[model samples]
Target: MRIRDTGDLWWKNAVIYCLDVETFMDWDDDGIGDFGGLVQRIDHLADLGVTCLWLMPFYPTADLDDGYDIKDFLGVDPRLGDVSDFVELIRTARDRGIRVIADLVVNHTSDQHPWFKAARRSKDSPYRDFYVWRADEPPPTHDEVMFPDEEQGIWTYDEQAGEWYRHRFYRHQPDLNTANPQVRDAIAKSIGYWMQLGLSGFRVDAVPYFVSGTADDHADGLDDPHDLLRELRGFLGRRRGDAILMGEVNVPYEEQRRYFGVETRTGDEDDVQGPVGQELTLQLDFNAMQYLFLSLARQDVAPLVDTLRARPAIPRDTQWATFLRSHDELTLDRLTDEERQEIFAAFGPEPHMQIFDRGLRRRLPPMLDGDPRRLRNAYSLLFALPGTPVLFYGEEIGMGENLDVPGRLSVRTPMQWTAERNAGFSRAQPRRLVAPPPDGGYAPEHVNVADQRRDPDSMYTFMQMLIRRYRECPELGWGEVEILEQPEPSVLAMRSTWQDASMVTLHNIGPEATTVTLELDDIPADTRLVDLLQNGEQVIGKDGKVEVTLDSYGYRWLRISRPESRRLL
Candidate 1:
């Protein structure tokens, strides 16, 4: 049971690139992306300094929820490629020291899945218990529903079975009865299957709903809601102790701790992190992401400060996944209506761009109006935060979205490779391609890797430089954060220290120039400030404080160095 790992702790400081295989590239003329194209493009990721690849759901599906409605948990989609192509892709990625992760969508499956189909056919079917079904009509009204834009209710009646089935998301995806023992075994089987196929871990979807039932919710003899998650943790640990399990639990910030399980040694009596790992290795910091948008809109740092203070302590081994955008909409559900409206007015002025009254269906560059200084400032804050940063594909070159593509699909267009047919993503005709690629200013003709790679000031080059600098400073990923108090509310500053290494970052969130002095008593009096982001150097003042003047949206990253410790690692 004590399997040894590389002990690289790679996930902590990793720069993850998330992409959908089907929209990434298409080598065949089938008008869809395939693994053959992905295998050939592994070198591009390696060149970008990517450490991990987070693949969207590629399992067999019924064209529902963009493959999240998994129909076959153990097989790859035939449209993408055969099993051998997946193996070759993983092998190719491994050769460059990159690890791959996939989505584990266990919350629900397509209603057409064999288990669900068989269960709905007869009440006596062995698989009947695999899904949650009620003999009586469900409650007329209920909360705790997702996809309110598309789903009318949480429970839908099934005439064939003469009962109601529960679904947290789309009606086509019926929630699995995770409390059942056989269902738990089936989940374990899925984990083992992918691990054996060379995947490093999985991005667990809808985690809270996985354990939604209460004491009375399971009258058919099932384990407690918490047991299933604990079992999944133990199962993965037995096979590979360093396995990563990233969860997406969209709940209140305080409630997220339950999903990030506590890992403590027996009789230790301490909730602090230890060698033993628990439920989730990393959870997306939705609270911080949502608050950051508020801070951006108001040009104030109070929201960010509050979010930091409210952050519950996590196990030392566990980390957070921070991102500017992902496959789904940018969620603002945690903010108040007034706050949400203010942000909507500032970033998403268009009515159709805002969706479900809780999210923005546009990309970051478009929201910022393609301002280069603001772009650098916004992304600088993202990378400086206390988490592993994730970059959505094509964002390095500042790709925009297609508003007319419908729903969240507006942001899920194919990757723009160059200024060619189909934006160099595929050779297929425009009508047969995936979600339409941007055609105007953000089209491949104007913005793409081929053009940005040669420009020194392009976002692509900036990212390469940023990643190299990030890898040199391990403290950003594992350090303790302390917010520095400043007189100006629009200026944000913080100090991050890990052991003997210490660095300070400052940013002007507003549109006006600002001059602020940060008091520092812990640093040595003789220390000098060496800018890590290629800025000039400056000496500490006699008052034990440093003063700097910043233009609108300007930022600085300075490392505290005492002559002997001034060089970058």
Candidate 2:
């Protein structure tokens, strides 16, 4: 069955931009960003050429976990404007040919949520089964707590319920029991309700934790936990044929494949059947992201090349979401201790710049020391990767993180729009702003949207160019990646070929300019290499080799142009 009735899976080539309502823009001047302010900035996103806007939970929350501790799944936080404002934002974004997807935080809920509050009230309460609970003194298990810096254990004793409840992340946010049919139905209803309100899809939070049910909580009917994903996928397909479910499952490649669904076989083991995408439409490539930072840290592209080549092949409809920096910390937990320290030494040398002993609480600009060449090269590689690219809110303008803020919030500062008060995010006082903008070199005065928009060579304009070129080259998004062999260890060379179209991209991650000759087999001699970033083309020699020169930390996106072929998109 076709996943999308449109015949075009938009996500395969979509550019996703993620932002938080409380930090994006403040229209009410209450020091907090709202939908009203977001609406005013929809044009900015359109101008940036993003196809998908991933909204970080604007739901009514207790405001403890950066909106992830959802108090009400169906209602928008009054602070961020009412339901009407949300609908208007969706409408405006849609009018600009952009699809909106919300953060689905059903893995857990705020302890203050009505259901959780009711569950804690009595032992036999109807909502008691809404959460995972253990009656006796919970024995110590080897289940590692998510936040070792704060929480010491995953199970927290609840005095009200007279039992120990499990929480994968934080104590204030309790995990919901998916094993319960009613709870599963409630989750499905929430998805349907949001889709009815015009959301294209969801960025499902903590998918592994959401599906990993406890042994004691097992039930009949849904024997395998993955069946729940199949159920949700089927429901989404029926409700909206093109809607997607992007999951945040940061597991090993093999384990990650399970979340994408298994190969369906009707006959014997030898008689294998075709594969089916019964689960998530897309997943974040945490492994590749880690290797990317490692490559940047060491100024060597071997790690990244290895990681990309190691990725497991999945079903056609499913894809990977590539990102450099996200809303959370730049997690390096997937890497080895030695590799993690190598990144920390290069990027997060100071202790304050590190977080949770596993990741760096910084953005790419600051990590790269605000070097424009390096930043441009990094973003170039991001778009050239073999997946849909995702950009954090402030990435386009080269925003830096405020290490003063504690933990991951360091990177979750307000958007810098201008050099004026509150960085043009709001009219409120500096103290009242949602989160203070970065100070010093990377402050709003030095780096902002207004200033960058005016500068022709600004990072914002560079990002716009990259987005434009990326949209033009569909091969980069929907093609087989072939890592081209080159001499320079600091240069990453690769080719992406989709059908009749082919493109070759090269990145010099080092600080010195160099030239590399690549052997392009199968292509006819004297073929022209059409440069996508610049206004020139190089002809391939008769030996099927081409010499390309690059500046320090430079990149090139060249489309193979054969004689008499007139496609120049």
Candidate 3:
């Protein structure tokens, strides 16, 4: 199938950098990252070859649900900066050739929000129905609480109103009643406000929970919620034509299809198809992302390849948002019990496994036993994958997870700017740290950008070279992927092809050296293989066989072309 030229310009050949602005920079020294602080870092992101900046929520929030618990849709959190700060941040990022995609959490609002407060004050309050309210009956059994450790049920009893309210996430973050037309209209207006300020797109949060479970059905699929999304899409399309909308539908592969506008598996009346309403462009491919992590952690490639092959073909103009990790708590919910057991069996022998699973108690690489070689291999696979790659903040510098801090705070450590006090995150004293700063293990003394920028063999430099190669090769960005059939389990190979140009990508995951022999008959006899990483390491002969040795965890991207077709570009 041919790719549609939607003229949706921002995402094409883009490398999106996921930046938690609050944790990115602290220019004002208020012990928090503000928009003005983020504005100052646009040049850094641009220099890194990032085409889009996916900013986490900057909305007015109670800080309980981070910024997801929006109290005011039109305002930015005072702790983060004002609406003016956000506008300036967007403008500054755009000026640096980086498009901005903000988080739009429409599924829920903070309990302290004016609408929620007014709703709870009295049963007859006009805002009472703005959020889901179970009047006389018991709270819906199917409505399960996402945070079972903190809350027992999805509904909390409101003594003042003599009712129970639904909350799919934390109790303080109540799920909006999307079935209500008023709520839908309000959310649309909020989205429009940002669109008017030159926002490129939105990374829609918790899209599957927009609709509650029906009396007979308890699943969080898009059975009845399609209408809500359809309505939202219609309103947003009218306000801002061609604006991208990517939903965070973290569900099984079967159920995820619904978020892409295919309502049901069967072609029945219940099945809705196409864009939920207007043609929504993309949805976060959690399926692929999860499989990728599993493959890396387990040191297995088959499951990942199987999962990738199983995914339904996406529209050519649209693509998956690939990532290694994100700001959310690292829960093993994506893995099945058997798969978890397998991962444990493989990694459990290592001491690092204890720290890795201890729920934010350890730093990143140290938790993985601080092996830079392993880190390099992980990133090689990440960058070579087929999709829009999103680098979690500080990952390029080899930042580790810090679990000693509280509540999903490990991945949210302040950017290690310099090895100065508190890793140069803030001027605040050690005792006043919002979240404990990263220890000296990965501090600026060793892993800072400044130090690595000068070293040719450093991981930072390696990543820069790889990204530069990706930028140089347009085929690498939009080429078709073909996995090579190889006998060795440790050898994973694939080819990216666009028209006459092709690139053979080979990755060695084994600890021992292995020779890969390519049959000359399988490819063009007159073809020449140029090693991309080695700056023109070439292979000359093609006597129906060509052998090359790969180092432990080494990767190669060979640009292949027939001698006669040397001008292939």
**TM values, all candidates:** 0.95, 0.96, 0.88
Off by over 4 Å in 3: 1-9, 136-143, 212-223, 262-280, 344-364, 519-523, 538-546, 562-569
lDDT of each: 0.84, 0.89, 0.70
Question: Best-fitting candidate, measured by lDDT?
Answer: 2
Cα displacement (angstroms), candidate 2, residue 385, comes to 0.8
Tell me the lDDT of model 3 at 56. 88
Write out the backbone clash pairs for model 3.
Answer: 360-403, 361-403, 361-404, 362-403, 363-401, 364-400, 364-401
The model with the greatest TM-score is 2
lDDT by residue (tens digit), candidate 3, 494-566: 7787666677777776676677765545565556787877755446455755666778877788877666554
Encode model 2's per-residue lDDT on 1-569: one tens digit a residue. 22232136889989999999999999998999999999999999999999999999999999888999999999999999998899999899999999999999878999999999999999788988889888877666435778788888878999888888888889999988877788889999999999999999999888888734556567565536687888888999999989999999899887988888756465332222343678999999999999999998999999999999888777778889999999998999899999999999999999999888999999999899888999999999999999999999999999999988888999999999999988999999888988899999999999899999999989999999999999888788778889998889999999998877898999999999999898987999999999999888888899989899999998999999877766764
Clashes per model (N, Cα, C within 3 A): 0, 0, 7
- Report model 2's TM-score to 2 decimal places: 0.96
Q: Which model, 2 or 3, shows the larger lDDT?
A: 2
Clashing pairs in 1: none
User: Which of the two candidates, 1 or 3, achieves a greater TM-score against the reference?
Assistant: 1
The whole-model C-alpha lDDT of candidate 2 against the native structure comes to 0.89
